[model samples]
Target: MILLQANNVMRRFGADVLFHDVNLQIQEHGRTALVGRNGAGKTTLLKMIAGITSPDEGTIAKSKDLTIGYLAQDQGLDSQNTIWAELDLVFAPLHKMEKQIHQLEDQLASLDPSTRKFQLTTEKYSQLQADFKKRGGYEYESRMRGILKGFGFEEDDYQTAINSLSGGQKTKLALAKILLQSPDLLILDEPTNHLDMNVLAWLEDYLKSYQGALLVVSHDRYFLDRVVSDIYDLDNHTLRHYTGNYTQFMEHKQEWLTAEWKHYEQQQKKISKLEDFVNRNIVRASTTKRAQARRKQLEKMERLERPETDDKSIHFRFYSEKDSGNEVLDVEKAVVGYNDQKLAGPLSFTVRKPQRIGIIGPNGIGKSTLLKSILDRIPLVSGTIKLGANLQIGYYDQEQQQLHPEKSVLNEVWDDHPNIAEKDIRSLLGSFLFVGDDVYKLVHDLSGGEKARLELTKLSFKPINFLILDEPTNHLDIDSREVLENAINEFNGTVLFISHDRYFINQVATDVLDMNALGIKHYEGNYDNYLEAVNKEKATNANQDESQTTTTKPKKSSAQQSYQQSKETQRARRKLQRRVDKLEEEMTVLEEKQEAIKEQMSQPEIATDIGKLSDLQKKLDKFTTQSEDVELEWTSAAEELEKFDQENS
Candidate 1:
């Protein structure tokens, strides 16, 4: 049940081969991940597998009737239809069937019951009903609603046009549509880019139940660990498969590289010994035959090439001009936003010396704005922000706002440090992996990864005691991110940064500032520790919930409580309706008995039988009493149901 396979696949850029003779296969319900460095052509390989691009050298085989759904990196949904309408399109076939069923119903009602056309229409309606039910027509809307909610879209947002959403929201909408489609093979590239923790967790749960093959390309290690089981490492113009999650892959990869390099080194030493013997003895008169034999053997020996490795990663550290005071920053009742509209914060926080704080929140909750407000790049809506003595802040904008796009890569850094010698500046740029021709390239022409590297280069040279970064790891590759993390961890400076990379936060953050509409709250620990605390608190609250289920007290999570309440209301209404139906059934039996009793009483033979008439009269009285009681019970149940519905609604 292999859905797709790329055999002897080759992809190239100009004359440079990205990967050659790469073979990959995905089963009908397999999960695989394609991982490599940023410039290792992972995306190109994905496009080829997705059928959006053709392989340069080999053919891609697929099972007949294979449906592939590809969600590109940051692919946005731009449509005139509302969010609900866009999602509903996933069930287009079912929707068409629904319309056809209605038409058949109309035809059945209008046609004569005895006609052949009526029978044919009835058969067609039954067939359509079966197909529609198989396609989940009855529950598609509810599925759409649930998936949308999981992606952070509320019921009210369903009516909003797709084009009206932000880029991140649109990307999420696209992901939701693909998940609903449930194609045989799902190829997703960086699907976790814009999702918050809530959405990310929901997606993990959803994908666990997805009945399709998944081939994903992402740098989110935690996401990879949770979602994928196998890893395809694309390195040095080839692909190697590894078993297990991201953490396991790292361990296995290191073991493989070690073994490979060891074999190569052993062969190299043997070849060196043979060459030395041939060189020393071939010129001598003695042992000429032996030298000839050695020469022949050396010529015949198969040489092992050195193991390939990507080692030219950026290496630099934050250089502090001087240590700042004990208190680096102070904010009292600070509101951060644009104009008069507040995104978050009528809040307070302190950044002490050398404390690395990571800011986290949902998209558009003003995490970046908070950084700018503290730096005084944008005006605060209210209150005060104070910087302590001997503070020189270095800011890294995720968008690369600090760099001049018109300037060369070298000049972007050199222009800021005009006093530095040209040779020294070149040395600094070289350390950041901008060497020779790379330095001459304009900042605008640099790729996202390059821009990030260049930014880090500039930041490393800055003598600052306070670093404020907004999404600093946005464009960095896994290797560079790790290097940056090391630098940040080692830096003796105060740090405040906004990031959605949980791995990065976990690696570098000493404390986390959870931002929301209400304000920012401080948690003392790394991201993982904070999550543990939150989960522990949830479990505690859940235990309390059991005891307080009958109370009117408010719950910690309003959303969870509301969902539980709605489920309970639905259950109660269903139970009440069932009781009403039972009463109706009982009443029907009693009425039928009464009709039989009356008919017997009306019979000419029975009219003369006084004893039979008395029996019939008693039976009629019993039936009447039973029917009246049933009617009362039915009325009471129905009334209670109505009242309950009103209260809940």
Candidate 2:
């Protein structure tokens, strides 16, 4: 069943047509993502669906009882109310029903049981009670609390006034309220903008398990991939649907575009040949009829336009003057914190050159503060920060304050690096998606994301070996983020950055610097490896804690010693089993290779070649013999491991 449908939607702004003859149908429980370029009619279409703004010409239909909850980019809540009070509004209906039921119950206790009016009122009260119970009204408060907590609102902040909260905090609170309402359709615009990695993951899980449909407008590729199963691309004043996640959509779209381009090219070639033939033969008396026919066919043929490309891509290049000595940054007794809270310890650590380090912590922690202190933007209470020799740093600040608001986009790059030519500056800005009129736009008028791109453009144009980036993925769409990630992966410079984008960190980070209550702990691995190490450490700690509680004193009994020995033996057997599993995987590869060779030998053309046939036979025999040996070893190890487990049990 369709939850909402819009037919022949036409919307325009002044003299420009945003979209024309657009038709959209949102089905029940559909998860759709809206995507397009910056000025595309994505947000405009969403507004029409939300009924916040009327389309110039369209008919929108919704189910009789359907309810929609729209979260715009700038979510405005009642500033005077507290966060708890705002969330409580979601359960206002239930609260009213409860009050009415309570009043009826009081009247019934005081009235005669035989009165018809009293009996009717009592029956109505009972029905209301049942309805409330069915809707989990009794646990509504707890459910609201849970939703708020899941959205990263703390218990203390719940009582804080909404007016005191920051813009990002208010957006989170608005999202919590929307979730609690349980609307039939959810329209979210840039929901992941203010979310951290953990909160983003939580929201993803919630959306995946939600019963209603979702129409999200976001630039976060990873978030879209997790929450949306379909994409409605609003481009060129038209809508195109792709039935898959973002990655699959990219693949399918690429394939379709490639095929279309090939057909278009072929047609163009044929048209060119036909035109030449017509030109040469039109003057000949013998082929006049044929020439005329070809000319008519050419006139009727439809021309194909070339696909648009991302031409405004900055040419990113890095230059290293001299490889820094061992240490890139050194901090000693760093007392870093805000007004009343201390996030980490006053400890010391060394950052080495050529190390791609990732700083991770919860939102509102001192991660950003630490970066500022290192750059001398913020003063630490007590610490000495040392930089390596000749360490010219290129910083990508999340706020992008380095950009002058009055300057044009083109001038922002060229003014800083005066040595660069005007043409080269234009080319650089173009690479970053500032083209034609976009280059002339004032910095103050640019969107938050566009400013970020411009900052990166400037950084890329400069020659620097050390980079300090904070949330570099901010304001970048998925494709742009992927391009930035690729550039970073290929860069041969030292990098220390803080980002909540797990996908970005996983792709680029070579070392993990975890900022927790215990201070900055260095782990030598990528994000996945670091997570595994942390999990293993947690398991070990849990085991130690359990053992400490169970055995406060040393056990001197012979049976206890034997049990411990048996446990050790079982662990060793499991380790051997893992090795045997590895060997079996290798053997499977060999068998697959042997099968491929046999299939090739069975081919008629290959069978005609004696030399190739002999080679295949030899390879098959070798693999078969190796497979048998692997099977034997695997079986023996399995049996031994099973015996050890049985003994331990």
- Which candidate comes out best when scored by lDDT? 1
- Which lDDT tens digits does candidate 2 get at residues 1-649? 9999888888988898888877787889999998876667888899989988888987888888899999998675756988888789888889888998889899988989999988898889889999989888899988877888888877888789999888888888888889988899999998887787778878998998899999999887767766788887776677777887665677677787798899888998999999999999999999999999999999998888875533234446556665566678998878776663566667577788778899987777788888888998877767688888878788988888888999999888787889878888888787777888999999999998799888888788777778899999887766677778777765667899998776677667778888765577888766655765776677666667766545444434563355345434534664566566677777788889888988999999989999999988998899899889888888887787778678755
Provide C-alpha RMSD values for all models, in order.
31.3, 14.8
Error of 1 at 322 (Å): 1.8
Worst 10-residue stretch by lDDT in candidate 1?
551-560
lDDT of 2: 0.81
TM-score of 2: 0.77
- TM accuracy, model 1: 0.81
Model 1 deviation from the true structure expressed as Cα RMSD, one decimal place? 31.3
Per-residue error for 307 in candidate 1, Å, reads 0.2
Off by over 4 Å in 1: 110-121, 280-300, 543-649
lDDT (CA) for every model shown? 0.86, 0.81
Q: For each candidate, what TM-score against the reference?
A: 0.81, 0.77
